[model samples]
Structures are given as structure tokens and as C-alpha cells.
Target: MSQDSTVVCVVCGGPAGEPVYASDRECSITSLCEVVPSPTVVRFCQACGHVQTTEMPGIEAYYDTQYKILIESEEEDQLYAMSNGQKVYRLDHQARTLLRKLTPSAAARILDYGSAKGGTLKRLLAERGDLRVHLFDVSAMYLPFWKAFLDEGRWATYRPPAAWRGTFDIITSFFSLEHVARPREMMAEIASLLKPGGTFYGIVPNTFTNIADFVVIDHVNHFSAASLAFLLRASGFGNIDIDEHAHTSAFVVTATAAVQQGTVAGIPRSEIARLGSEVERIAAYWRNFSSCVREFEDGRTGRPAAIYGSGFYGTFIASCLSRPLDIRCFVDQNPFRQGRRLLDRPIIAPEALPEEIGTVYVGLNPVLARAEIAKVACWSGRRLDHFLP
Candidate 1:
């Protein structure tokens, strides 16, 4: 858990300043089931107010061959929310948000960089048939899914063709930056791929909003507003807009590729100190999370329980348990995850959960855990104890 002084900030190329959080426990990846037991150390850059983790070994190979996100089926998607008793999926919401933010002109050339399965772009194309869309990613595992909507010429693996350089009007990345160890390099490539005055739109996790991101091992860079600005400016982007509240636990950003490289501004000392303090507070939370969960379990030993989400939080809860066998199943509202298995426990819908289970661990975002759990009408009259994060 020692800090590597040679590690530089991905945004500003400054030395990694100080260690903020370090852990030796098994950490979960974005693809919930994958776990890394190696020690994790997070460092904060004083110059740019950026927080980043030590890169995972063989991270490139891992993402290319091992990482598997929502690839079960073409219809599978993460649950965004429950709108008036209707299930709203994530891709649909993302498409709506992007369209509202930037409406492309007819026949505009657009590419979804690091676009796994190109779900968001597929949804967008369905709305605007005149827009020309392309897909790019490191892995070819999702090529089958992309083939359904895009022609072979419109998609590429490893890297896009040289002919694609400076040809795109719009480039979008959806929750891909955090996983990359060299974000600055990635941004430079994105800039080269765009025409002058072209826009780069992206969504990255906001660790300050979603504390779980602080401990996710696969997320190499944990971006702050200041760090994001630095990244875009250093990569020759201008007219940048970063909106934190546009999406839950994410930052929505749009930056235009400038004809000339933009000047990088120095962060204020006061702001650096403020960000450092905030990062320390979040680190302390994860340091004590396991102990808190253990204490909660101690009070209800021998009682059968269920986890209320099949994502990262739920997997983390199971990892912290003293007797994981006590948990009978995982309850999820998303139909895609209902029939799956996490930690050898069946993931069932709320209505399908056995009535004998007396306790429920709400393994969801702490900011929305309680309210989401309450929305399940099936658990209304049942005398079940709920452990909320």
C-alpha cells in the first residue's frame, strides 16, 4: 500500500502527491463478479486536485479479453429508475439526455469511442436515421452486438482506421474514461480523431457523488471537475462544459476541439486544499465500511437475509460477510439481473424472494438506497429488517 512517487497525474503530468486511500481487501470491478485481491492504493495530485488509483496489472489485456459488461443479450440493460410504475432502462435515458443536450444535424458523422455494444448510439440512431454513426473499442467481443445495427465498415477493434482521422463531427465516450490508466493519451487520440470545432461528449463517474467509485479497483482515474477541465484543456479542447448534476453519480461533459491548443490554467491553492479534505473524508468512509457491515451482521446472526441489488454494492456486501451462506438470494428490480447469480447466490426479483427471509441488506447507492428499497411494494407488510448503506 505504499505510494509510487514516479506515478504521474493523468491530467497534468504532475507527480502523484500523497496516498489518500489504501486497502488489501478483495476489490470488485465494474463487471460485478470479477474480483481483484491485490492491494489498492489511491493518490491525490496536489497540482490538479485529481485522485487516481494504482493501475491494475495487465489492465489492457483485462479489458480486451476478460472484462464483460451487460453482454448477456441485446435486450439486457441496467435499470435507471422506476417512472410511474414503469421500468426505465439506462440506455434509453442516456439517449434522451444526449439528444436534449446536443442535437446533431442531418448526416453528421459521429463515433462512439470505447462504445461497448454501442447501445447508446444504437438508441440515438433509432431516433435520427439521417445521422451516420460508427463504433470503436479495444475488444471485439461486442462486435456481434454492434453488427446488428452497424455495417462492418462502420466499426473497428483496437484502433480506428487512419482514414477516420479528423473526420468525425462528434465523438462520445460513455463511462469509459475511469477504466483507462492513461486518460491523457486517450484524450489526445480523441482530439486527433475529431475535426476542428468538433465536440467531444462523455460521461464519467463522480466519486464524490457515488462513494462506491472510490474503492472500485478497475477505475484507474477518479475525476474531479478541476481534473476534467485540465484533461480537456491539455488535449487542445475549448469551450468545455462539465455538469455534475445532469446525471446521478456521473459528470456530463462537452468540449469542442480547438484549432489551437488551449492554455492550461493552474488550480487555486484554496481549491486544492478543499478537494484534498473532501477526498480524505471519502477514503475514511471506505476504510470503515467493512467493519460497519460486520457489526450489523453480528446483531442478526442465524437470520436468513437477501441483498437488494446485484451490482457493485451488493457484491461488496457479500465480500464483507463473516458467513456468506446466511444470505439466501439477491433481490434486484432489473429483469436482466433477476435470473443471474452473484457469489453463488441466486438473484431473484423482489416478488420472487422467499417470504421466510427476515432481513434485507440494501446494497445500492447510499444516496438512493432507502428510497429505492421503499418502492418495492411486495416488502410492504412483511416484517423484515432492512440494513441500508
Candidate 2:
């Protein structure tokens, strides 16, 4: 994709500046680590300081037909953390966060927008049985899972029913906004779906906090606090609150519907420059990441290795290596991914790793990758080498 000057910013109507980051490769991997012929080119809007990538061709069809996340099982969930020897899952954390932020009236209507499998709402309902919940998504693939907890009349696919407008007391979106190509239109739709003074609670990845999101090919929008504020205010939402530190690498936001749409103010030029410089720094880091992995592989050629973490980071490490076959398998803590195969290599528990593998490639988030690897007691005393990003 060319970095055309005429490319428009999704957040602000102004033309985007020059490309902040562009991939030389013709194909890129999705967050799920599936390879596709979509080169990434990220740009920032000088008008609003919003950083975003050009939408992938046929993105709508891609999500509707090809995008499947964590669908291996109904119990599948991302591991949030290991707290005192117990696993804290993503869905549990999301439900708790939402409940802590807002208290709904008895039997208040709630909708999960862009809900895939509706896992978070299912967990929420477990805590509050009195709530009336609904689910909506672009695809019908997850209807079977929704059928377990939701009535047939409570869920819709593709477009929501027109009668739903101005009926919901609370609308929630979890990790959905960043994937959208047109966020303004989505925010408008959410605004229209809510009752008067209804709440819109959602979460989006914070690129500043999670550096990995900056290069994820499927994440079209990299929202900053300033840009999120602009999106909500311009979309007829008031009482906006964006919490950056509430969740790791994500911004938890809550906004109330307003009677009149508010004007979006121009971002300061100095603030824009600051955000631009930070984006460039992150882009440079990723540019060097591939080379770092290749150099590591070159020195340890012919040695048996295993990649830890089967998500995007681990798949990226495999993509960088000239000899991917050297990797015997992948190690992950998530039970849902343990039996799966990435690059034809089986994913297994860390304890199930072969004894012959002397080196391990840590393909987790750079922020916590090293610490997580260090916590693996099974690898301790084995004199194994670990290459952490």
C-alpha cells in the first residue's frame, strides 16, 4: 500500500501526514498469527494526533468470514496473569472492571457490541443474574456459543434491529474499537443505540503502553487518550473518562450520551509533535526487532530451540528466522492453545518441552516477557538459554 498524502484520518476528517511506519514485506501477519497479503503502513493525523494504519483491502469481508479469535472451545480464554499460583483470565478481569465502573439498575438492558462469543457478558451475567443482556457482531459464526447463555431473540448478526435504537441502558465493547476501519461511524451508531443519558463503556488497546499493538496488521487504529476523547466528544458523548492505568496496555473508557453533539477541539501542535516522536521511536524498535532475532538465530544455528507463547510475538520470531525448522515446538500456558500447531510445530505446556531443546525463544510482550520467563520453575536448574525480546 502506498502512503498517499490524500489518505484521510479515521478520527479527524483532516488528511493524514506522511507515513510514520511502513513495512517493506508484501505480506503481514494478523494478531492471530495468520499470514495475509496486506502490507502495513501507519500514519498520524496532525489535526488530532491520532495514529492509524491504512485499512486492509476487503477488511469487512475478512472479519465477517475469516476472522476467528479464541474459538477453540467455549471455555477458551486468554491468561491475564498468575496471581498467587492461581490463573486470572481475561474475561474474568473484564467483567470485574466493568462492574466496578458502573452499577446497572435491576434488569437494566445491556448490549455487547462487536462481541465475539460474548464471553465477557457471560461472565458478567454470572455475577449479576438480574441484568438483561444482548449480543451483536459482524459474523454469525459464534451464534452457537451465544445460544448457550442468550435467548434467540436477544442476539443479532451484521446489522442490529432498528427497534434497538435508544433502548439500551449500557453498551459495552471490549477490545473491538481498534480493529474498526471507521471508528467515527461506529461511535455514532453506539450513541444512537443508547437510551437518553445511557452509558458507553469500552476498552481499546493503548499503543503507547503496549508497543506490540503498533505493528499488529489487523489493528487499524492506535488510540491515544487525546484521540479517544475526540472520538467520544464528536460522536455526541459527554462525561468522558479514559483511564490509562486501570488496565495494562489498554484504556478503559466510560462516556455518557449527551443531548447535543460537542465540537472537537484542535490538538496543540507541541502535543502532536511529542506523540509523533514517540511513535517514531516505537517504529524504529520494531524495525530492529527482526534483525535482532535473525542475529540470534545465526549465532545459534543448528541448535534445537522452542518458542514460548504461540500468539503474535512468537509467530513473528518464527517469521524472522532463516531456519524455522530448528524450532521443535512452541510452549504456552494457555490450555486452549496447548494442543494447537503453529507452523506445523505442536504447542505444548512448558513442562512438556523436550529435554534436547537447549534454547528457548521468548515470544511474549517485551514489557513482561523476561519476567514471565524467569517465573517458569521447570526451566530453572536446567541450564537452558533464553532469548527474550
Candidate 3:
């Protein structure tokens, strides 16, 4: 990221002159903090309102350096546990939901472009069952983890059975477009990979959630639904639809039959700013309401005897349980998430739990938790008999 070079902003095609700053190295799995020299940071495009870094790391470099750190940071810190984790409804249900808006059979091969460990793909295949599935990510580390979720013969990748080229029905990227140096190129690649009538369904972060921070930090390209629609048309996608999923602060875009790249579409600059403000207002309200409903409790026990799981619902449950229970620890099974703290209380793995003082209030659907725990090899014959009327 030397100052002598110039790069184009992926969002607006503006020139980002030289990378100026770097991000702190982070590992998502262990939440370890290792301070590093700042990498180069870039500026925004005045024409299309795209902000990007001047130097885009190679995909290989991306995986080894910055990308791994970002991911490992989340895993180490149990970030998804801190925030409301994205939940997967069955893939069939997801496909059917989209089919209501998208042509069902028009999508033959489904690829989740930013499929992190294939959660979305699993849900899609879980529903459509017949579609050939492919999961793509810049990092190979997550592939093995995601593969466990796929049926033996159902999923493949870019390094696959050779017949997958240009044969997809739908390609999707959920919460993963803003980081790329050339999103349009990525889309074009996706388009080239798609059959003409094929659709590309994706989501990019807008001004939702902690996007303001993410924009300055993890993300390089942010898009309003309109701006993203314009990006799609430029990539030669038609029948483009922009839908806002407000809570995550993302725009879900569906484009069809992308044969020729179109031009960049954007509203007036003032409108983009106004859209940001409006979304911020809605976001503030959502946060306030969530705060009101989630109060940390003290159940007289020192440990987290209340709340649900260690992810989103767990955070809510624990945050709320803190209001009534003496939640000293948060429980989870993911080794990467154990030993951290949410709202200052320690997060502990189930294996790390000691004999409780008394009482356990479940948050992640009591029935589901009970069933899942029952399936655990160690707890198979155990009775959860701590709570009594």
C-alpha cells in the first residue's frame, strides 16, 4: 500500500490514493489481541460514493493475513454470540421464501458466494434438495468445517468436478460484499458463472447495526439498496430488485439474466445521506427496544443460571437475565467461544461448568436446549433436575 500508487474504489470507482492505514490483527476464534502496524486505508469515490482501500490483498494473502485475523477475532471473542447471531431457517424454507419472489426452477445451481462455512447453503439445499450447491469463500480454513454440514454428494467448490463452470441457477453473498476491492469484478465473475436466466441474490451492509463502525473498520465498500442495484446493472444484471433488511443494515439484491454489465446507478448525494440518517433512526429505536426487553437478572446463584445460549439469544438472555439472576458466567459448547465475557460476565464452555449452586434458566428455546443437551454423548442418561417448583 505505497503512497505512489492509485486504486479504484469498488463502490463508486473513485480513486483511493495510496493505502494509509492498517487494521489491528484480530483472530475470530480465540479473541486474542495482537497489535500490528496499521495497513493502508483509502478514501471514497466522489462520483459513485464508493469508499475503498487502495491496495486489495490477494485472496491468498487475504486468507493468511487480514481475513484470518478478522474471522479469528470473532471466533476468539465469540462475537456472533455477542451480537444477535444470524439464524438459519431450513434451506427449503429459505428457497421457498425466495421462490415467492424469484423463479423457483430458474435457479438450478445455487452458490452462496460469501457462504461462511455454508450455513446459508445448507438451508437452501435443505429445502430445494435437488439443486447442485457450491460454497465459495476466500479462505479454505472454513471449507472443511462447512463440509460437515453438506450431504455427501450435494456440495462442491471452484476446485471441483469441472462441469460447474457457468452452470449456476442462483449465486448469493450474505453480509460479505463490502470488503472486496473489486465487487463489480466479483459480480462479473459470478455472472460469468451463471446461466443467462440465472439470478444473483446477495446482501451488502448499509447503515444498519454497527455499520458506521464496520465501514471504518472491516468493510471497504458500503451500499444502499439503490447504489447496489446500480452496481448490479453495471455488471449486466437485469430484473434487479433491492430489498432492505433493516436490522442487519443490509440491502438484499436480486438480479436476473445478467448478460451485459450496465452503468452505475445512484440517487443524488443528498438522498444517500438522508437514507443513512433515516436508517440510523430506525436502528436506534431497535436497540432501545432490545435494551428495554433484555435486563440482566440475578437468580441468587453466582453463575449464569438463566438466559439461553452463548450466541445472539444467549446474549439477550444473559443480558436480560442479569436483571434478575446472578449470572457469573455464560455457557457454550464452541471451544473458540468459551472463556470470554459478554457485558463483563465470563463466558464458559459447558465442559468448564462446575456443579451449580442451583437453578438454570434456559433462553434458547427450553425444549431445543434440553433436546440438544440430551444428544450430547456425556449427558445421554443424565437428568436435568436442578430446578424445582
Worst 10 residues of 3 by lDDT: 27-36
Root-mean-square deviation of every model: 1.2, 1.2, 10.1
lDDT of 1 by residue, 1-389 (tens): 67467878877998987678888464645544566766678999999989998888888898898888888899889998888999989899899999999979889999999999899999999999988999999999998999898877999999889999999999999999999988988999999999989999999999999989988888889999999998999999988999997777899999999658746889999999999999999999888988988999999847699999998899888888888889999999888898888888899999998978999999998999999998999879898998898
User: Which ten residues in a row are the worst by lDDT in model 2?
Assistant: 258-267
Q: Which has the better lDDT: candidate 1, or candidate 3?
A: 1
Q: Once superposed on the true structure, which residue ranges of model 1 sit more than 4 Å away at CA?
A: 26-31
Give the CA lDDT, 0 to 100, for residue 159 in model 3. Answer: 42
Best by lDDT: 2
lDDT of each: 0.89, 0.90, 0.53
Rank by TM-score (best first): 2, 1, 3
Candidate 3 lDDT for residue 253: 76
Kindly give the number of clashing pairs for every candidate: 0, 0, 48
- lDDT per residue for candidate 3 within 343-379, as digits (tens), equals 5766676555556523344534332456544443553
| Ranking according to lDDT, highest score first | 2, 1, 3
Candidate 2 has a TM-score of 0.98
**lDDT for 304 (candidate 2):** 94
Compared with the true structure, what per-residue lDDT tens digits does model 2 show for residues 66-100?
Answer: 89888878999998888877888999999999999
Cα lDDT, model 3, residue 172: 77
